[model samples]
Target chain A: MQYLSVVDVARHFGRRKALSQISFSCAAGEMIGLLGPNGAGKSTLLNILATLIAPSKGEVKYGDQGANDGADVRAQIGMLGHDLFLYPELTARENLEFFAHLYGVTDVHSTATRALHTAGLVDRGDDFVAGFSRGMRQRVALERALLHEPKLILLDEPFTGLDQTSTAALVGRLRERQRAGCLIVLATHDLDVADGVLSRAIYLKDGRMVGSDTGSSNLADRYRRAMDRGPRNADSALWGGE
Target chain B: MMRAFFRVAWQVMRKDMTVEIRSREILLTTLLFAVSVVLIFSFALVREGRAPDDVAAGILWVAISFSGTLAMGRTFERERYNDTLRALILAPADRPAIYVGKLLGLLLLMLLVEIVLVPMVGLLFAAPIFAYPGMLLMLLVSGTLGFAAVGTLFAAMLVRVRSRDTLLPVLLYPITVPVMIGGVRGTAALFQAVPDEPMARFWIGLLLFWDAIFVTLALWTFEPVMTE
Candidate 1:
């Protein structure tokens, strides 16, 4: 989990190429954002990194190991994809407890209580997830993904259903994780929300890594410039990300 | 490693059971569907003064197979509805353990349905169910295990498919032919006018062999089949 090296990674669905020759590497404490227009393969790249799907042509090395290294390495990884991955019928506490057991977390009862408390849903812990609001569910889902305290956390549109306050809370949580030396890779369209938290933003366009923006201020402007000014030739998608 | 594997399986089974107990969605639906199938046969085949000879075995297996398919579809449908299967797959626990847990849960549901359907078939068709209860129980357990082993795998594979409801039985029945044959033949031998204990015992052995093979194959393939 010290280094995530995606080397010449490509994913093709039958004849259609979802990603090609994309390479990037990041270390602990770095929060990298995958930024692009829709269908730019942001989610595809995240799936590849999460080991949920295999890349067609390259390797995503989680430190010195990869998906072929067996699932013991997965204990260091956590993911929140497009699906919330929660059962609506189960209470929030039940959901957390079930997952905690799967992840082999100790002190199941107290661990679930702590997760519910972190989600700010301790009072509603006994309530079914079906009855919870979208933001509430999102918060609980995030806590569920983090239950095992994974070093590598992949999030896709983590702010989608959040209000302004929840968004701030999420950003704060990400900051805390970042400060704790966990690597966070996220694909999000909310540039303003991500502007301050991301150390580097990787731009992808048409299944290739087009450019990156590492500047601190005016993220929206930088993103526009990166999207518009990048070379459009076949070979120009090649990028050496820090 | 064995302890961890079984521990995860037990937790998964417990979770499914808890949900089932509270909702009873799969259990109630499966029980009613099975009873309806048996009742249809009772009305259609049972004559004024006599029941069709050996119709009991066919009726029992048919009801179990049809209702078991329904229960499997509903059970996995609940998982795919919220994409919970993906969550379960993402866990660090052994993937085969998840498969076993689901199979165990489905087997339990089908067994509960069989508990009612078996006696109903006996009373209506005048089959001597209690005469060979021990042999009959072995046939049911082995037959159900083999069926569930294959059915659970296919049901899980179809969860993300658009036409999963129409597809489960289509895939399950063909692969579980051995199980159905053993169950029907074995149960028939016992319920006949002169119970053939040896025949029933042979079929039970064959059913158990099929169970081991189906479960091993299912466990080996569950991870790959489930993967995207």
Candidate 2:
């Protein structure tokens, strides 16, 4: 019954429209993909979902609770964005433990250790993230975001730069989370990896929702087709991401 | 609720201190810069081994404020570097608690630098060394608290801004005038050949008042300013 609903959400930045009339809803146990090309406002939508920014218009409801419902609402949401949010000066374990503590996770030491194991960085847990390769840091950051077992996870470009092996590992982990019944909303250009894993795809272009459906097919082709169409002709189906 | 707020604040402060302990980037740069400021003024203002009247106190505060800006600049730079501020903003902790934690961390760093700075100014400028230790400590703490209360807020506000390095001082120095006046005047009264106990006490009282106002304002506005 838990769900996230966006009602006519729009965000603008000083004469520039980042997102406009965007509307969708995703229920728990669903994984929705925000697919688009550059400047598609995918990151903006993700930021709005994470409560990092407010929409200039409309409202976002998290199971009848909004972001203004206070810190408790934020506690149930986790995010991973372009920055990775990990301190390079801190060791991998330290980074995880720090976030675990902030998230009010009990038994922080063990939680961080478990996260290290999940990231497959148990051997390199003590090493500073400054020296980590892109894929390695990405994995650690992903675990950091998941440490609190958040009910909702917002990720922007979760798989930006990765090798085939790392990409496969990340996809597998995401699928595992999907099975755990955590609602996930990710902005990704890695359509090939996201193809069938997503329960639905919401295609956006120039700050508007262009297409959306329970399209469990070749995402790249679907994305191309969606982008080629006009907004008036595109499908704007609003579902609970069931 | 109070316990949770304080705990999160302590965690944030401890994390900053840990990073400083490991890196020493801010501390070393700030300490060396403060000492250099003191020494340069001692040479420029002192003549025949005698510093001009009230110059030592002015020199000390100028050093503190200039070096404090440098220190405060680095406080959020680390967060801005990796966009850790985004992570922090997304945390479930009360926004004001996070501000308090950052202020606490900055206060400790400023006090550490002042420990070396005060004595160095005394020795170089021939100011009274042991006139009143308690009064000097109170002035330092109150002045630092007031100054850093404003600095922390501005630093947080400027984290995502461009040309922030050039902007921090421009924004910081003008806003912290009352704090600087209270600090310099209070310390001068203490350093004078005839220690003006009542005069130093007045400035200390004034600085404490400013501390209350700045801290309250910063805590109140922190959440809104940071929300973006």
Candidate 3:
């Protein structure tokens, strides 16, 4: 079943067209990478999918439900962006507990502990996040995002600040979540990570998608070629053909 | 629904208190600031040879009101610093639940500050703030509710602005003048043994009206502001 869908999605920040006629869909148990360079509307699309921001035009749906059912839709979705959404003064356990409660988890302590263990922070769960290394903090953030066992996970640049070991661990964890029937959409500038983990990839340039393919090698080569094209008319390529 | 609201409110309150317990910066600073303001007022009154009764209520409300702003600013600062405000908005609870939670938390802090200020102001200025204890408490509750409602709204709005620190007070003070005026007068009436004074009743009604209107507005507006 298609778990997520977006059609004709467009966003405007004042006068700048952040996204125009963007359309896509994802099914259950799929791992897709939204590939793009800077200023390519990656974050904007992620924000719209997460329901953190509204689009100027278009419809986004989760399962069969429309995005206007924000609170209900939000219940089934979890997101990790570049920002570490945990409190610095809070311990990893406390941070997880807080988000768990927010998600209306009845057994907050147990859920939080499980998430901490999954993030490989069971030992450091008692330490304040302020004292944590960047990689450890990212792990805690990942745990927070998964606390509710969301059916759909949206990650925007989730690999930005991670060390090598942490990055591999995160990828492994994401793969495990995908295998468990959660639809995962990750937006990243790192092609290597995308090539390794993503089953499908979509390349975006200048606010429009240039190419989308399932094979990792083809997608990476097409993404690089599009990037090398050096900022041409994105609208003419992605939307004009459509 | 009430259960959900209270659960979120209690959790937010607990989180805020834990942070305050760990840092002790907000409470200590607000305490020191409130005391200093009272002291300054005392000195000015003494040098001018004015009776404590003349400005006692003004001094108390001024201290409470200004310290309330400091408390609100700190609340938003903590949320913004940690990105917890965004996390709260994304929570499953209804939007007004977050607003009420933050407002209740601020009300508690404001009451705590008032508890400390009432006695200190009475002692330092030699005015009997606690003379009509029940009436004084009522005045405090009414005034604090109004302040918290408006302050929470403004704090959420200013959290994202470029000049939020200065913008908070600039936006808040003008809007809160009526509450300040009504609070000081009502408090002064209580201190002067005029429990049934017509002016005190009028101000109390005004304060209550402001509280109801702003609390409703804050709850409605907080969702958009927090998301934005």
TM-score to native of every candidate shown = 0.95, 0.96, 0.93
Q: How many residue pairs clash per model?
A: 0, 0, 0
lDDT for B162 in candidate 1 is 95
Candidate 1 lDDT by residue in tens digits, A1-242: 45899999988877667788899899999999999888788999988887777788999888888887656767888888667988888899999999999998989899999989988999999999989988899888999999999989999999997899999988998889889999999999999898988999999886888888677768898889888865455333333231
Best by DockQ: 2
Q: Model 3, which residues run further than 4 Å from truth?
A: A218-220, A228-242, B48-53, B193-198
Models sorted by DockQ, best on top: 2, 1, 3
- Candidate 2 docking quality: incorrect, acceptable, medium or high: medium
Please give the lDDT score at residue B86 for candidate 3. 68
Winner by lDDT between candidate 3 and candidate 1 = 1
Docking class of 1: medium
Model 3's CAPRI class is medium
lDDT per residue (tens digit) for residues A127-176 in model 2: 99999999999999999999989889988998888898998998888888
Task: For model 3, state the Cα shift of residue A71 in Å.
Answer: 1.8
Model 1 chain A worst lDDT window (10 residues): A233-242
lDDT of each residue in A111-174, candidate 3, tens digit only: 9989888888889999999999989998999889888889988898989978789999999999
lDDT of 3 by residue, B48-123 (tens): 4445454778999988888889989998888887566767777767878778878888898888888889998777
Which one is best on TM-score? 2
